[model samples]
Every structure is written in structure tokens, then in C-alpha cells.
Target: MTFAATVLTLYPEMFPGPLGVSLAGRALSEGAWSLDTVQIRDFATDRHRTVDDTPAGGGAGMVLKPDILAAAIDHAREKQPAAPVLAMTPRGAPITQARIRELAAGPGVTLLCGRFEGFDERIFAGREVEEVSLADIVLSGGEPAALAILDACIRLLPGVMGAASSGIEESFEEGLLEYPHYTRPPEWEGRTIPEVLRSGDHAKIAAWRKQRSEDDTRLRRPDLWERRGGARAQSASGARHEDRDQGQ
Candidate 1:
């Protein structure tokens, strides 16, 4: 089945931007996935089409009106009821590669792109929306995060990547950072490809790759290494949940 994606945002035109190029673009053209954008402002009831208002507790930035956001989410649900609704927020759980893989395997997904000071708190509980965070940093808006998320998901769809295993060994798939890669020139700046890689010994190469992945994860992303139970529980799989700070 096609992995359908519906995005609810104030800037509907921002979508299919970078997503319209490269692998994602190719997948979209081939019908491996689909995109639908919803303009949250379209559900506004005011003459000015206002979708945000002053923060309830007297904050500096305005907050998206819950009613307008609810309306837009409901509309998206009507069209794609099987899809899960995710609100992009800094206050949400950090997104992971495992989560992206799950979404790619599902019927589809609905993304709520927050703007201004972000969504009203009530909308999350009342609408049953799942909060998702791209990273620790903040952005001007959720559109960029949404685009990145969609790209990550789209590239995993069947037939999107040239090789089925193209994504399987990448970082996070096995709770470890990916092994370093090297290619011809064989020698660059006095550096040569690892001898084992050129030895034509598949077994040795695999062993080297696994060792590199573990060592790098332990060194570069100790957090991920720890989450997988550190060296003691190296067999652990999948992602672990972590708290997120608020972002755009």
C-alpha cells in the first residue's frame, strides 16, 4: 500500500518543497507514497482568518487556537482515518529512526505543523494528537521538521531505495552508529582503504563493520549506546523514549 501523508499547517505551500526532489520526489512520482496539505487557517471562523491568539497565561508569543487546529485535524481524519496524528513540537518525545520505519510501514501518517508560540495545550489531549520532536534545537516553524520527517519516511518505502538493505545497516537500525564507509581512489592523501575491506574476505569485512559500529556508537553517541543497555546488553534493539524540550 502507498504510504500516504497528510500535513496540517499554516503554511500549506511549504510542503512538497524539498520533498519534491531526490529519492522522495522519485517515490512520489512513482506512487510509492502520497502527500496532502491542509491549511489550518482555512478552518478559522473570524473575518480576518486568524488562527492564533495571545497566550492564555500572558506569554510573549501567540498560541495557535485550539478550535481552529481541531477543525483542521478533524478534516484530515475524515479523509485518512487510519493514519495517526502527530503534532510537531519541541515539547514532544524525540523522534527516532525506528518510529520513522514504523510510520513508513503503516497505512499513512498525519502531521500537525505548529507555528507561532505553538499549539494550545488542550488540543493535544482533546484531539488525541501525538507530539513529536525532530531534535533538541528549535526552528522558525514546524514546516522544516515536517519536511525532514516525511523525507526520512518516504525513503524507506518499498522500491524507493535502490537496494532493500540500503537502510537496514544505517545508524540506529541496530542501536549503534553505522560503520565508516570508504571507496576507491583506494588511497587519498596518503590514506588507504582498510586492508580487510580490500582483502575480498566477506567474513572478515562483516566482523570489522560490526566492531566499528559498536566502537563508534560507544564513542560518538554514548547516550544511544547507554540506551541499548551499554556493552552488557548489546543485543537490545529499537529506540528508547526520551523527554524533549519545547521548539518551534
Candidate 2:
């Protein structure tokens, strides 16, 4: 299982430092995954390593030359033919846990980080690239967004986490938020840990966790609840069908 990522950017040095310190870092060192950075400037034509130019129609910042970026991506694709080329931009689809899971389950991926005024729109129009965004706000560059995505996907790889179920139990796995957690020193500042947690009764703890998760979702993100109505309906229908079969 070779999980690899290629990042296209002028600032290749920005990576590996942050990505090198965590689970992703360990994965790279242990050969479970790989990350390669391609300097877009290396593909420039001029003597000065010029990868950006003035916009065709006049703009505030220089635009990344499409040909240069394209060459960089092509080079990476040649090395890893199975990698998916993704461009980071505020105009792209919103990144979510589901998307991260989808990417992690794939062979590999390539991240294109844009700088200056951003890449020529033609790159997005012509290339087979998926545009992704971290949030509604804009960042100085795509490096941060690319790193954010890399971190999310790498941790989901098998063996990267200590427990396989840790990823599933995390928030958004069940269409509801996760229940609150408590640690040692059951009593703190006049507050006591929930009795269900300390009861040592597994069945009661499980029920309490489920109910708390639902309640947290309702309070924090009611939008997930609205979207989950279809799933809930399907579950009800399945239960009714099973009941009828048992009666027969």
C-alpha cells in the first residue's frame, strides 16, 4: 500500500516541517506513505526562475503561468500515474470529514498550491483537477489548505491510528456530534463526572453516550439532523419490515 502525495508550489520548503512532526511524518519515515514536493519555479522558462506573470487583462497581483503549473503537475503524474490532482482554492467544494475519508481510501493524491493572484482560470477549465477549499475565508496562499487536507487524510490511513475504531467514533461518523469525555479525578471544582461513566456498567454507558451524541448534535449542528431525516426514515421502515416477518 503506497500512499503518496505530490505538492506543486514555489514554496516547497513550507511542507515536511509541519507534516514531518505528526502521524503523517511517522508514516513517511516508516514507508507507509510518501510526500514529494515539486517546485513550480523549476519549470519556469526565464533565466530568473519566473513562474508568475502579469494578468492578461490587468490585475492586482501576478498570476501563475498556466504552462508552468501544468508542467509541474504533469511531472508528478508521470512519477505516480494513479495520483489525483487537486487544486486548492476558495471557490472549490467545501472540505469535510467525508471527503477526507474518500481521499484516504484512494491510491494517492497530488495537491496544487496557488500563490500570488492565483493560477490562470484556464488551468481549472482544462485540467482534470478537483478544486477544494478549507473554509469560506481566504488564506495568503494554498500551502495552509494543502497541509490541512494532508493531515486529515494521512491520519485515516490504516495503522496510522492506534485503534481502528478511533476514526469512526470521531465527530461526524454517525451524523451526530461526539459525546463529552471525562478523565481522572472524577470530582472537580464542585462538579462530578457523569454517573453513567463511573458506574462501570457498559450497557448504561453506551446508552448514555448515544443519547448525549444526539443531544449535542441538536444543540451544536441541527443542520446534520435535518439531512439525516432520510436515514432515520429508512431505519424505521426496515424495523417495521423485520417486525412483520417475525409475526408471520
The C-alpha RMSD of each candidate to the native structure, in angstroms, is 7.7, 3.3
Write one digit per residue (lDDT tens) for candidate 1, span 1-248.
89999999888889799999989998899899999998998999989999999998696999999899999999999999999999999999999999999998899999999988898999988987999999998988999999999999998988999998999989999889999999989999999999999999999999999999989998999899888875445433222212222221
lDDT of 2 by residue, 124-215 (tens): 77678899889898999999999999998899998998999889987888888899999989899989999989999999999999999888
Worst 10 residues of 2 by lDDT: 222-231
Worst 10 residues of 1 by lDDT: 239-248
TM-score of each candidate structure, all chains considered together = 0.92, 0.89
TM-score of model 1 relative to the true fold? 0.92
Q: Judge candidate 2 against the unseen true structure and give its global Cα lDDT, from 0 to 1.
A: 0.88
